[model samples]
Target: MILHIDMDAFYASIEQRDHPEYRGKPVIVGGGNGRGVVSAASYEAREYGVHSAMPGRRAGQLCPHGIFVKGRHSHYAAVGRQVREIFSRYTPLVQPLSLDEAFLDVSGTLRLFGDAETIGRRIKAEIAEELELPASVGVAPRKFIAKIASDIDKPNGFVVVREDEIHSFLDPLPVERVWGVGKVGARRLHQLGFRTIADIRRYDESLLKSKLGAWGAHLWRLANGIDEREVIPDRNAKQISHERTFSEDQSDFEFLHSVVCFLCEQTAMRLRRHGRKAKSVGLKYRREDFRTFSKSKVLETPTDETAVIIRVATELLATMRQTEPRPVRLIGVSLSALVGADAPTQMSLFDDPGYVQAERRVDRVMDQLADRLGDSRIYRAGSHDWRKRPRE
Candidate 1:
């Protein structure tokens, strides 16, 4: 059986767990102003129409009593490690999709663990008892169904879909419950008289395929409870990134430049944190009209250096202006073509021999300082103050 484990409102839940005053209150983790967007909102806030990715001002209007807090990504990373350690105890075939969610293939471990549902209960119990965190577990025979089942009932839910019951369990569920059926897809499916998975199952797959293209056949199989995807372990990331959406469009190049620097630093930090380096830097920006542009540059050497990342990202953003001056609603940086930190580099003979070493030292110091102090608390304004030695 496959097991999917998803934490309940991970960021906001962490905030509530750390701060006693935030418990039962609508906790929001992000800036609650026009300059920011919501990162996560507690279940309490969801009742008031607040959600992640929503504008902070709208979240505030929806839940006026919301308790807004800055996200401590370091804390979240630490907790994620703890959660991962718990998953490791059960099975080695674990694939983490994010810090708060993962898929575990327990087919081999079932013999030692009794059964799939038993293992799921034990795992959920351990998380709640040991870490005081609520986790929803879904155990099924397929990967996609397991993910969907885990989310079916959340915030301390456990659901087991037996092999014999997969069809019945899926039949009456709305067509929207199928993965990849977003707003537009759902509306189209509804217009085709597909209110439920059963309706989809009744339709001819070829007819549906002709109408929806290749995706229609995929949806038809899903409706009939057929998912062949495996839970492959060690699905290491191909890239690391960070992005931000503004409450209001930002037109100023100076301001956008600062945002790019911040995003580069954030992405580079994450790259290093994983003991990886990127050989390519990618930039993405969405205009006020919702049009998006993306560009990337491959580097001569893989690096997790903040300076190099920022320089390349800034250059990519500058290329967008050639089209026309446009206000940006969102901006992001991505680091790809990841390689191990120990990967050998052929440093330029023309460049200083100590250049790479100096850059690593600076990034290490900054990483430590950011962990000790908040990420936003420190900034490099063209100075070496961070390199100064303390009293002996």
Candidate 2:
């Protein structure tokens, strides 16, 4: 069976776990700025309509007494590593969806671990006991149902769906319960008198296809509890990126440019950490009105160089700013189309032959420093003014 594990309000939970006084209080983790968005909120905060991705300004209005905290990505990454280690002890076939959620294929380990339900319960208890973190576990014969089952109870939930009971468990649920059926899909399904999965299952395949296009058949089958997907052991990352939201809208080009340089360096360093390089660089920005857009440029060669990524990102930012010259609330940089860091470098006549080697040596030293003192402790020359000042 496939077991899906989701850590409850992971970032907020971590904050509460680390700080005993924060427990049972409405706690939030994110940018800690008026313009910032909530990355995660504790269950207490959720009762007041505060949630992840909500505006920090709104979160405060909803839960005025809530404790807001800045996210410590380095600390969270360390805890995530520990969580992965716990999963490894149970099964090698584990796929991490994020720092807080994963899928474990226990089909082969039943003899060693008992039934799927037993394994799921044991994992939930183990994570809670060993790490002092609550986890929800969902077990099913297929990946999709298991994922859905995990969130049903939530905050230290364990749900098991045997093969024959899949339909009963899913039929009465809303179409939105299906993973791929988002707001748009759910609206369309509702329009078709398909409020429930059971209602969706009653539709003819041809009619579903005619109404919903290519995804119709897939949705219909999923509604009827037919998911033929396997639990893959790895969640491959396609891009590396970083962004920061400001406490106030920023229209100044020079200051935003400096932020872009810092974001580029951070992303490039992360790419190098994975022994990867990116062939394309992109920029994203959100206006105070919340409208966001992005643009990208393909490079002639893959690179993990901060200067190259920043240059491309700055060019893209200029293009975006020209189209929408509003005060920006947030800015981000991303690198995609990745290759190995050791991918062949095509030397150009304009380049000094020793330059690439020199950059690598510098990166090696920086990596060591970052490993010992965290990424925020070090910065490039261009990424100044940010260390001491908050986004506002």
In model 1, which regions exceed 4 Å deviation? 33-35, 235-272, 277-339, 347-392
RMSD to native, candidate 1 = 7.6
lDDT of 2 by residue, 219-330 (tens): 8888888888766653245777788877667998878888898888888877887789889898988665445678899998888877678778888888888988989877
Backbone clashes in model 1? 0
> What lDDT does candidate 1 reach at residue 24?
93
How does model 2 fare in lDDT? 0.82
Q: What pairs collide in candidate 2?
A: none
Clashes of each: 0, 0
Q: Candidate 1 on 29-82: residue-level lDDT in tens?
A: 875664366768899989988887676777778888899998787788789889
